[model samples]
Target: MRSSRRWRRLCGGRNSMDHTKQLLRISDIAAAAPDVLRYRFTAAEGELAPFLPGQYICLYYEIDGTTTGRPYSIASSPREAEEGGYYDLFIHVGGSFTSRWLGQHGTVGTTIRASHPLGEFCITPETPRKIVGISGGMSVTPLRSMVRSIVDSDTDREISLFCGWDDPAAMLFREEFTALARGCDRVRVRFALAQNPQPEDKHGYFTAEDILRETDAAEAAYYLCGPQAMYDTLHDGLTAGGVRPERYRREVPGELHCPPYPTAPGECYPLTIHTGSGTVTATAAAGESVLVALERAGVSPRAYCRSGSCGYCRSRLLSGEVWTDPDRAPATADGVFHPCCSFPRSALTVVLPE
Candidate 1:
């Protein structure tokens, strides 16, 4: 009763926050791919926040006492967000977080922190552009939720999903998508394979000519969801193939910036951080992001996605200034910033974005 009272008090009051803000637990984790696991997390009861149909969530994970976060599009529909149902997360069971998920020997009730769903990926309730999905491998994650939501609503639009995989095993949602396409009258599904296959086989790599042969890009809204190399290859090809820049929507592997931004060696500087709650200052070396310096300094300010993507490690530029490689800092009107990849040019002053 005492512990529950504390939990209730901490989440209730003026400026009160809810358990919705804490680390949720992994209620169940299942295997989907040889290298991928589908995680179903249970937030505190009655603590699930309402989310949109096409939004993504930032997941906070702790491995070997180290901190990090990655944002993933919710694979479940908004309808599932209510009624204390489950939210689905898919991760290739490798690397740090993947290793932990696979190694934990954990099961029901294992805890994990999941922030409120955040992202702008969504399909409109009314906008009807010929929907074209160019998916590669696990790129079907987000689109599956979209297909479910769209079909459940029974909207009037054509959804043509073009999926490319090396083999049947590489496919993400083969049976689920096939089932949806079978039932929906307005949905047309197409399959493409890159590997040499049986005599009766699908095409490969979703080339420009293949895209043109399949669907006229002139009046279509295209969504490309896949890895970095794949996104780059298809984006350039589709553009050259006459797909309007506006009509193409691709999901960025948000935190994972390829070829890590070039930071000149031996160009380090000092950093000062001030929070309304407290302040800590340190010297940051070049070739390292402010987030790294803070973490090394034992300043456990919240953070996620080392790239300036998820906006979780957002701090404020209180006095001194810093420089972002692309200068595309996600600073809101309140002056919050992504400390993850942000570097110091001169002596700098920053505070947690309130």
Candidate 2:
């Protein structure tokens, strides 16, 4: 019956609006690095949805009896997605719900719920002719897509990628990147090892100085994806070196760790969350985010990247003021905020999306 329903949905036998979520079956899995696995998923039927090379798809999982979602970057190129009817995702084992579940239950036949591709971290026609991609650790997933897309499309853009890994043995897609460079004259690849530096790899981190040495920072467009500390360091270094703020783009992997808001004496506020089930009132600690308050009340709103970049925990600020982390805050009009990085300044009434 499930297969029939899915087939009907694909064949336009029923209302197309009925299927909001796409069901994908795991077709293959391989170890990409130490504790990192590459998974390939295919639509149950029909062609897979088209996506930009660097966009991500949110995968839904049931954790501790609660359904939640985590976004994973598509590591495959657009050509691969269209020709192979599949998408590839590289996941690092970080003890998160999705990682734990994949470790135990990921198999050739396991089915999963996935949202359509989303996000804006990709190359465009407006992108500068010279591009620099800096990736650290497992954050290379999206860059892998971008590089593959550039190569497969035979784009005229000159691309340089500086990728770092913890160790030589833990380098994800090292061989593939090397081969890509060998095959493409327009591409240059560099690797850095943070620990136990190998003979072929650079000894230290990929710093801003290295970027300036590779290309004119003022004239090139840069794409950075990795930890927040890496982003901050490079952002500061580049800007200090005369790189314009609009010349670079960045995406921090997973949730953001925002410092506690400095509150005045006796400034703890109460947060009222309005959901479909009921209104739950919780204490918003001096430095805690509204999401934390909701979680304290046993209310789980759908969240993925806890960083405001994913916009997964966006809620309407019905009343009262909230403070957001300067780095992760969204540029929005009043009455809208992302609870993942927002802390209440006063008693607040928030309406969560259903």
Candidate 3:
């Protein structure tokens, strides 16, 4: 593990919050799509620490005196981390923090706190030789990193990318991906447009035939990142096409909205929160997850992949009743649950980390 001193040096004039947290200064900002901005953070003094190509970092911010954070994929390649001491991120406008603060008040030289690179969404030693990457909208960020890293390393591994969007203009990294495919024989790229596809593009969403035509879906490793609907469609389509469930991994970008509670009590419950420092009382909404209720009461717990996949916001359900999806809940022997997916059903007492 490398020290975050490099990041701290880059964020000069800012104080480091802790060993795990580092400040990042935005070095450049440019338009990536219609409502998205590609932000670059440059290292001023030392080299930016290296991270796995598809891994992400939690960017934290203080809004109205309360701290909050969101996870975003590092769009730049590991080669950039070594040579340029910088990385890129795509932020869509009109969200909670990214939209509320960065999109509105952020600019070149703006600074913020962030966690060290984290996540297992990257290629591992056990990854198969052939890879098929499927993405839509801003979800293309991580795939971009993997593609760029593979190209930069001059690896012999084969990659096939299928990007989907509403139209040609809505597709991101089109020019870059086109050039990459034209230059590298190991890489192949395809685009699927829901409307008005060009001569060589496919129409509508990606189908099994579309994927099978490019590569052997059953033999290749699959990476998926996109919206819920897109993920469901592609996953089912690929599974039906002989792709094994264990051969594929997915990461859903942006906020993971919880499903509506069919039998919600429809009443708020008193909540007692116990942290390392002390205990605080708040109200947990029956309809919302405990994570949302905590945030609503001005308490921000470290969270990533709000879809309940990442166990960042794991808290002990000391004394309470919560309805959670056993499939999505984290596996733990302790009396703990991921607040992001667990909704309070009655008055509760919970314990959180400092």
Candidate 4:
């Protein structure tokens, strides 16, 4: 491990955060797709920390004086992390501020703040079983980590991966995934092309029917990471096919894009939020997420992975009615909910964590 003094030197003598936050420098960048880039980062002066195969790191960026963070899945296996002293993140050029900033400034030697790995979507080595991974578009980043880990560790566990993209040019990590399949007998890789597929690819979107046809659906531990529509289709199809819920897990890449609430158009509701410091009130426009409402009122709340997969924005729904994206809604217990994916349906009150 590198010393803190070295880290400070590499980071221009900046003070380190007490927690897992680190200042890292981009070491390399490679085009993964037409709109996707693979960014490799290393500790300014020390070895990078190890992370689970399916975990993610939050990257913080300051744009127009507003600091915001976005979570990107770790695309490298744990073994690679230990050996290379770096982390790999595959980012798509989306409409988000962070993605736009990265597209412009993600050059080698650019220093940025990043959180340590955080997420629970990983394989438990002790509970080994046949594994099936399903992913779509850039969401394949974490699944690639899981699959690579399995191959690097020389685990005999049967692994089946189904990855889909809009087309061959849109597919990220195409060569790498194909190489892994060729090297490992227990690993099976399939590609789904949604449009203008080449002769070697499977046409159409990735569906539950593909999983059922390629792998042992009943016995394998299924891991899914993709768009919400994919989740809904797979969840319904798998359940109807008699697969137990416990045998499957899922992770959505970003905040849910829910349809407009059935309220009259242009309607807005009052939203009162009570935090440890004081109470803040704001108006939540129809079809807008409560998180956006809070931001609009200049209320700064700690949040990451705005897609609702991360529990960082969880708060207590003290009063009022809110509708959550069904696919991204966290399990509600004792009135707890993730406001990032919640839409106010009525005048609402919520208690924010300190």
Of the candidates shown, which would achieve the greatest TM-score relative to the real structure? 3
lDDT of each residue in 192-310, candidate 1, tens digit only: 77775444347567766677677767877788777767776777778887788777777755443322446665766777777667777777776656776766555646654355654
Model 3: per-residue Cα lDDT at residue 284 = 85
Compare candidates 2 and 4 on TM-score and give the better one.
4
TM-score of 2: 0.80
Query: Candidate 2: what lDDT?
Result: 0.77
lDDT of 2 by residue, 196-226 (tens): 8768888889889887888778788888998
Q: List the residue pairs that clash in candidate 3.
A: none
In model 4, the clashing pairs are: 254-307, 255-307
Estimated TM-score per prediction? 0.74, 0.80, 0.86, 0.82
lDDT of each: 0.64, 0.77, 0.76, 0.77
Backbone clashes under 3 angstroms, per model: 4, 0, 0, 2
lDDT value, residue 271 of candidate 4: 86
Of 1 and 3, which scores higher on lDDT? 3
Off by over 4 Å in 2: 1-20, 240-242, 257-272, 276-305, 310-312, 317-323, 330-335, 343-349
Which parts of model 3 are misplaced by more than 4 Å? 1-19, 44-47, 258-267, 286-288, 296-301, 325-327, 330-334
Across residues 127-189, which tens digit of lDDT does each residue of candidate 4 receive? 346888889877889988888877776446668889888867778877888898998887888
